[model samples]
Target: MGIGARALRQRVRTAESEDWDFSEGRIFGSMCTQPAPAAVAAARRFVTSNLGNPGLAPGTARLEEEVVAVLLDLFHGPAFGAGGWVLSGGTEANITALWMARNASRKREVVLPESAHFSFVKAIDLLGLEPRWVPLDDQGRASLEDARKAIGPRTAAVVAIAGSTELGAVDPIPALAELARAHGVPLHVDAAFGGFVLPWAGPAAASVPFDLAVPGVTSLAVDPHKMGMAPVPAGVLLVRHREMARSIAVASPYLSSPQTTGLLGTRASSAVAATYAALMGLGHRGYASNVRRVLDLTAQLLAGGRALGLRPAVEPTMNIVAFLHRNPVAVQTWMLERGWDVSSVSAPSSLRFVVMPHATRGTVAALLRDLGSALRRFPP
Candidate 1:
């Protein structure tokens, strides 16, 4: 029905030696089509062998509980009786969160920043709720003032981004939370990019404060694929109140044999197992340190960009760096020639780089070297 497995496998099998990487549905650098390590391999084997969801066995369910607990604890949610569930990706997590928020609300409108992920609009469309655009500040973060203006009683939810897609900006969550609380409305944070990464990379690194620590933040969407560095489909949807999630849970006759639907339907157990393995592979200190690596490298890359007359759209809050250029097309062409996978922003013809965990200082240096040479050849 949806993009089926046999077709996808054939497509991927054909791309085993492609020149560019495919991630988050985009192809840019050479990182895509790379093979998995042994942990991922082992997890895949286990998943295929198991007939059902991770609910099929003690080992799978135990690992699931462990992964959920660790994610819940790290994101500042209550460990006692609180719940965390996995999804296909951030899109699924965000859709579910949006649906849950909409179901909990008495209003019909959802307000989000202009730079909110496209999936939010898609989710809004799917949920049949009206979406209002909240303007962004000069710094590219969501405008607290605009959000305040947008929040009338009819406003069902105020969704703030924890690391926006375009500029890598973060909305002021504490400030946004205050506004949401005053109006007695729930705030959904789409930390799909920033969530797992932010607990390790804090306010000094992030443009805004996030996590369950923000009282008015009703729910959060986090992806373990990005900064969590797990295999795909390792997205998480966590709620501040377990009761709120009850609005979305419905009984199904399909679950009669298993006697449970558990939150989402028959999800892939391999993704859960991969994330569980990844969390253990990169524990608390390790995750924090890996995040720090990307931060430092982004800062490093931006420094080089500056010498070539580029400036941050907003100073990077995390591993993402965005800069404006009069002619991003030309610069992009130059970068592509040098084996870089940066994005050109259409909003203002800017350039943005999402520094992956594997992007080392050596990689940064190589990118800078090519950039410097290109800038000299074509002054923009």
Candidate 2:
């Protein structure tokens, strides 16, 4: 016998009780965060609407167009031409961009930074393209010299990261763009994390330039669900020229639309509406304020870590801070025991904290207190 709605809801809640306590503000291991109120409301309004076939669902398609236009403006690209589409977060966006590169170029090799997101590796494997990995410089950015050495006759594309997963490093995007342009190769910037935060980072924006303003940037990917605080699975991949996207397009005969722009046949237009609402609601000033606060919290956390004798893996340019500890596993266990959510990095044997909107100052201070106590018990 099937259970009633109330009973089913109760059972689901009981199962979800084991999850992290978002209300207590202890979680700091990932980019995921609670959606903004405006975005949530927008999603609720359009959750049942699908824009899979723009010709059939004209109204939903219009919402998607507005979302894309807003995103292009945010990324410093042209609002006209609508040279991009919303997809299912970073993985799909990255794969889609790589697929375009693979088809557009004669060569089958992609040169990427060692610090590039793992999604690129997945794309390389899936697309049957060779990976020419370039090492990072001392500052944890893709080394221009290394990139120059790595790219050769078979180099189809060069990939750069704006916000690296582990270190939160911003590659020298303009330099990479220059190199790619000179070699007649396409440059794709994976700014999924930084794309939403970096534009309004105030003085910090001077150091990071992974955007459409850079002349040689052929394509770019961004995730509205990350820093934009939109609902999940709202990623966008943009091409500088419309022809680049058309090169990888497939014919879709059955649908009202003649061609399919993305890998999936059916897509949630609710995500696009929510993303558009987020961008419009937050505006430039709102995001700048949010990013500024996160930066302050990050500084406080870094100071607290240093006080406990923890060494930072890199000087963070973004909200993510990774620090080296003697025993990361033990630290993680101790934090978990105290009801404080924390995570560790494998390569540097370190702990990482991502400062999001939920990680308030008071919660961060409490985290520091807990870390101090944990360190005293398990010293580095």
Best by TM-score: 2
TM per candidate comes to 0.87, 0.95
Off by over 4 Å in 1: 1-14, 19-39, 49-58, 79-81, 206-208, 256-264, 376-378
- The lDDT for every candidate, in the order shown, is 0.74, 0.85
RMSD of candidates 1 onward, in order? 4.4, 1.6
Q: Lowest summed lDDT over 10 consecutive residues: which window, candidate 2?
A: 74-83
Candidate 2, residues 1-380, lDDT tens digits: the string is 79999999999999899777556688888787777889989888877776777776787778777777777777778555547887889999999988988888867999999988889889999999999999988667899999999998899899999988888889999999999999999899999998877887767666657888787898889998889889886888887777787767899898898888787888888888888888889888888888888889999999988988888999988899998876888988999898877888876678989988788989999999998998898886
Task: Please estimate how well model 1 matches the true structure, expressed as its whole-model Cα lDDT.
Answer: 0.74
Tens-place lDDT per residue, model 1, 276-302, is: 877887688877888788789878888
TM-score of 1: 0.87
Q: Evaluated with lDDT, which candidate comes out highest?
A: 2
Question: Which residue pairs collide, candidate 1?
Answer: 21-29, 21-32
Query: lDDT of model 1 at residue 348?
Result: 55
Model 1: per-residue Cα lDDT at residue 66 = 82
